[model samples]
Target: MKITVVGAGAIGGFLACKLFAAGHDISVIARGATLHVIREQGLRLHTGNDLVIAPLRATSEPKELGIQDVVIFAVKAPALPAAVDAAKALIGQQTLVIPALNGLPWWYFLKSNSALSGTRLKAVDPDGMIERSVPTDAIIGCVVFPSCRVESPGVVRHMSGSKIVFGEPGGGSSSRISEVADVFLRAGFDAHAHENIREEIWLKLLGNACFNPVSLLVSCATDEMIDDPNLNTLFVEMMSELLELGNRLGISPKIDPLQRIAITRKLGKVKTSMLQDVEGHKHVEIEAILGALISVADLAGAPMARTRTVYALARMRAKTLGLLPE
Candidate 1:
């Protein structure tokens, strides 16, 4: 199948490489040094034991690549509007936009059956550009479980996990979702179409809501954030508020709050992507991961004192260090 991967950083580059190796017509949308490197030396993937180097159609301009059968968006949440706008050139009449992003995705409530159905999240979508730029009916919700980091320009290291969870936003198990899943599975990663993906989305958000910001604030790893007595207590309270919000939204989280904390603790000293972004002097994904939850809680009439407090503290800390803007 014809595919284009925008943002070509870590996950994007990794997917592009694997899919390219699997005989898909893959193109990468990258920029600056990364674009130069990929265009010069193709793309390089370091998968622990093996290194796969393959020539790729790397370009800085999305319009240059033309429309594709599928567009896998892997840009950060704060960069969503720009990402969506940039992806427009690749949207054909039948193109599927699969957003492999973190935290609460912008398309979360597009086709929901709740009272909040069709509600657009300002924290995530802001102006509904993503919703408008791409047809909602062509959107395929994707939750990435792989851990990877850009080793350097044109080179990415696969850290852990290979699963990519996907489902229709409206809870429909269509053949299209399965076809997309098959594409990834045939490329060698674990891919599956979920029945009730809302639960899965929340379950993943629970991890990000508790672990990511707290790790950034405390300057600790995942295990440290979960194992530290005082920090772990704070994490539990924040999760409780989130769980309560989930209950109000009619989505039951598969993992209990305490058990979730335990799992994080066992993950052991892994620095969260948010903390890493802070360390790199880059914008962290606070708004999508935490801010969106807080907004949703308010929309659902759920109290979020603990979540607000934690979010405020983290933002303040980041602001003080010039890591975030207000």
Candidate 2:
């Protein structure tokens, strides 16, 4: 299959290398230093002591890549709109578009079984740009569990985790979901086709919506935050509020607040992706991770007071640091 991965960042570069190595025709849409490095050398992935590189077709303009069999969006939420607009030429009628992103996605309500189905999230897609650009039928919801970072331009360092879950947006079985899962499995990932992708997304967001923003505000790693008494208490409160909010939205993730924190505690000193973005002086995903959740809560008339407080502080922090638009 011909696959074009938009945004050659940590996850995108990792996927490109893995898929290319697995005998898929791979191309990447990237810009600046990442594009230069990929064009000169190749997409590189470092796992432990070994390094794997794939010489792939790299371009900043999506038109050069033509329509792909699959287009995987590995960009952060903040950069998604522009990435989608730029990569329009790579998506066709038969193409499958997978957003391998963190936090609540823009298309959360499209084809959903919830009461808010067909509602647009202003936090993630304020102008309906993403909703207008990508076809709903082409979308396959994906939740990535891998922890990776761009060690350098065109290079990704795999830290831990490799589970990826794929499902149709509306839920139920589909051959396309199985096909994508098989593709990832062929590239050595623990991929599964789920019946309810939205539930999986909510399960992941239950942790990310709490930890990612808090990590940015506190400027600490996962284990450190979990070990601190006050911060741990704050996390529990925020997660509890999110749990109630999820219930109102007709999504129930089977884990409690304390159990979820325990899962993160086991990850040991792990730095969240949002914290890493702040440290790198890049734009943080404040909207997708936090704002989107708050928006959904408001839509469902669910109160998320503690989560709102944390979000305000984190948003102000990112804005003051110039990592977010004022």
RMSD of each: 1.5, 1.0
Query: What are the per-model numbers of colliding residue pairs?
Result: 0, 0
For candidate 2, what is the TM-score?
Answer: 0.98
Clashing pairs in 1: none
TM-score of each: 0.95, 0.98
Which sections of candidate 2 miss by over 4 Å? Answer: none
What overall lDDT goes with each candidate model?
0.84, 0.90
lDDT of 1 at 171: 89
lDDT of 2 by residue, 1-326 (tens): 99999989989988888899899999999999999999999999997797999899999899988999999999988889999999889989999999999888888888997879999988888999999999989999999888888888998998888889999999999999998999899989899999989989998998899889999898999899999999899988988898888888788888998999998788777889999999899999999999888888888887788899999999999999999943
Instruction: Kindly list the per-residue Cα lDDT of model 1 for residues 175-285, writing each as its tens digit.
Output: 999999998999999999997777788888888988888888778888766767898788788888888888887788777789987765654567777887887787888
